[model samples]
Target: MSSEQLAIRIEGLSKHFSVYHSPLERLKHVVFPGRTKGFNDFRALNNVSLSVKRGETCAIVGQNGSGKSTLLQILCGTLRATEGTIEVNGRIAALLELGAGFNADFTGRENVYMNGAVLGLTRAQIDERFADIEAFAEIGDFMDQPVKTYSSGMYVRLAFSVAIHVDPQILIVDEALAVGDSRFQAKCLNRIKAMKAEGVTILFVSHDVGAVRTLCERALWLDKGNVRMLGDAFSVTAQYNQFLFEADNEAVPTSAPKQIEESIPQENSAEPPDAQQAMKLHRPINHWGSHVGSIIEAGIFNQQGERSSVYTAGEPLTVRIRFEPPDHADRNTMSVAFSMKDLRGTDLIVSTTWDQNPTGFAAGNGPLVAEFRLPNHLNAGDYLLAVALEDRSGVLPQYYEYIEGAHYFSSLTEKKQYGTFLAQVSQSVHA
Candidate 1:
C-alpha cells in the first residue's frame, strides 16, 4: 500500500522494562506483606502513534535508546508493547539487529534456508532464488562454513539476502543495513526501493542523515522516547545538524588557538625572469584518501581548460579544489581558498565560507570535489593557492594533516597595480 492507503496501524504503542535487583529483592517480593514495589524502570516506547498504508516505505530515526528499536520490535510482534496495539496484515520479513534469528552454529547456507522458511517461503521458492541470494550475499565459499566464523559484514549480507528473497509484502529493516560495505548498502537500498515500487510496505531505520535523505520521502525523528520532528528529510536533518553543531562548538577555547597566519614577504629589486619558466605543478593520482589525513588539489585553469604555470601581471584564472577525506569522521567540512601573497604570506585575496560558495561535506567516502570559479584578470606575481579542510564543527580528526603545497600556479598575466585583485586591472591600465 502507498502512503495513501493504510497497511499497518499503530495505536498508542508503549513498552517498558523493569530493572531486577539481587536475589534478596526477588525473595522479598514473593514473601512478606510489605513488599517494596520499587525498581528502575525504562520506558522504551512511549505513546507513539502512526499509520502505514499498503505499499508505503517509512523510516524511524533516532539516537541511541530513543525507542526506535523498541517500536520496530513491537510492530514485528517479536516483543509485545506494554501499552498500545499493533495491527499487521500481510506477511512481513524483518531484518532487525545482527543475527537476530539465526543460530551461530549453523552454516550460512543453512541459516539462509532456515530464515527463508521462517518468512513462510517453501523449499521450492527459496531454491528458485538460491543463486540470486548467493550472489547478493557476496560471501563466497564462506557460505559453507558456520556463521560463527563470519565477519560482521558477511553476516549482514547473508541475512539481508535471505530476507529479501522471501517476497514478503512488508519489510522491516532496522540499522542492520549499516553493517555492509558501500556497494552492498547501495544494493540493499535499491532492493528496498524496488519493493516499495511493487507495492510492499517497508520500514527502514538508520542514524545516517545522508542515507535517510536519499532513501525516504519523509522522516520521523525521535528524542527521549518522543517524536521530536516528523517531516521532510532535509528540514529534519538540518535541525539535527544545528543541534549537533551547537553542542560541539560550545567550548572552543579562545586561548592559544590554532591561529590562521598569513605570511608574504616582499620588496626585492627587479631581476631577470628565470631562464626556465617560473612554474609550479604536481600530478594528483591515487592521493585521495589516507589513513592519516588529506591535501586539497587546487589549480588555476583558463576557459579552454588548459592550466598555466604562471600568470601575467593580470590574467584569467579559475581555481578548482579536489578534496579527499580520512577514513572516518563524525562530521566534517572542507574549505578551499585563494589569497594574494608575496614570497611572504600576506592576505591580499582571502575569501571563505561567509563570502562566496559556502558548502559542507561529510566524511567516510572517497574523493569529494569542491570548486570555486573567479572572473578573469588579476595583478599577480607569486600567489599561493591555499587549499585546506577543517571539520569546523570542532571535532578533532584522528588522521588529518596538511599537504604543504596542494598546487601552485602563477598569474603572471599583465595588469596595472590598481586594485589588490584583478577586477580593477583593466581600469588601471586604461587610466
Candidate 2:
C-alpha cells in the first residue's frame, strides 16, 4: 500500500518483562548481574503484525491479560516494545488506563493545557480549542477543581474531550468508555462516528461485542500475546464469542459426578433434522451450574410440527427443550427459560416459565419438557438461543444449568424490512 494510505504499521511486534519473585530478587539480580537476572522473561506480545489504513476504524478484542493493553501502550509510546518495528504517519492521542496522563493535584483546566501541550499543541492552539473542549466535557465548574476530586466518569469525560479537540489524526481508546454513563457513552460514540467520517483513524479496544461489530470494519483477536485472528469485525467477533463459550465450558470442573442425562427425545413427526447443519450455523454451546441437571437436546419446530433450522417471517415457531434432572433437584419450584439474540449479539427477546406462574412451578416426577411459543414478526435474520434451568424456592435462586447458544435459526422473507423487527403498518390519507 502507498505510504499516504497507511495510518499505522507494525511488524514483528513484541514486549517482554522480567517476572521476579520479589523485590529482593530484583535487587539481587541488579547486584549479581547474572544472565538469568533472578527472574523469568515473560513475553506479553509475540511476533504480531497488522496494518490500518488512514480513516479506517479498527478494534482489538480479547480476554483480559491477552496483551491488548501492552499492544496499545506500544502504539501510544507509553511502553517500548522489546522487539520489532512500528510506524506512525500522524499525530496520535490515546485514552489508556484511568488517570494515566493527568496529575492528581492539578486542576482540570491545568491538566487540559498540559495534555494538549504533550500532544504537540502550543499554548495559543490550546487556548483556541479550550472553550469547545470544556463545553464538550460538560463538567461545568469541575474544570476549575483539582482532578483528584473528580469521579472516574468525570475524568474520562474531560480526558476524552481534550483528546478529541486536539485534532488528532489517530485516536486510541482502551476500555475507558466503560466508566462513562449510558448518555455520555452514546455521545462519545456519535462523536467518534463523526470523526471517522472526517477521515480520522480510530483504534478501539472494548469487550462490548455489539459495539465492536457496529463501529469497526476490521478486528484483531489477541490470545496469549499472539494474534489469533484478524479480519472483518463480524467474523472475528463471532469466532471470539464461540471461543469464549468453549473456554467457559472447559473451565467447568470435572470433579463433579455426572448425575444428569437427556431423558426425553426430540419429536420425530417428519424426516430427521440435519444436526450437522444446525450445529454449523448455531453459536457454540456452553453450560455451567452445579451439575444437578442438564439439557439433553433443544430443537426449533415450525407450525407443521417438524424440526427445522430455517423458518419464514411471521411464521409460528416453537422451542422444545428436554432436560434431565437428578434426584437432588428441587421439583416444586424449578423453572426453565430461554433468550434469543440477533447476529449483532444483542438480546432481542427473553422469557421464562416463571412468567406464567410467578409463584413457582412444579414439574412433577418425570423427565422435564419445556415448549415455548415464540413470538412471530421477528425481522428476517439469523438468531441464537440460550436456555437455562433455575430453582426459585428460596430468596436466592440457584441455577442448575445454563446453556448458551442452545439453538440457532433464521427467518427468511421476500419483502425488505428495516432493523430487527417487522412492524405492521396502517395509514390513511388525511388530505
State the lDDT of candidate 1 residue by residue for 62-129, as single tens digits.
77888888888887878988898777888888899986888999999999889888878888988998
**TM-score of candidate 2 against the unseen true structure:** 0.74
Report the lDDT of model 2 for residue 79. Answer: 96
lDDT, each prediction: 0.63, 0.80
Q: Write the per-residue lDDT of candidate 2 for residues 331-390, one digit (tens) a residue.
A: 768788877876445568878888787655465665668899965668887777767777
- Give candidate 1 misplaced runs (Cα > 4 Å): 1-4, 26-34, 249-431
What stretches of model 2 exceed 4 Å from their correct place?
1-6, 20-36, 53-56, 122-125, 196-199, 217-224, 227-300, 306-315, 326-335, 354-367, 380-417, 423-431
Candidate 1: C-alpha RMSD to true structure equals: 17.3
**Backbone collision tally, model 2:** 0
Best by lDDT: 2
Candidate number with greatest TM-score: 2
How many clashes in each candidate? 27, 0
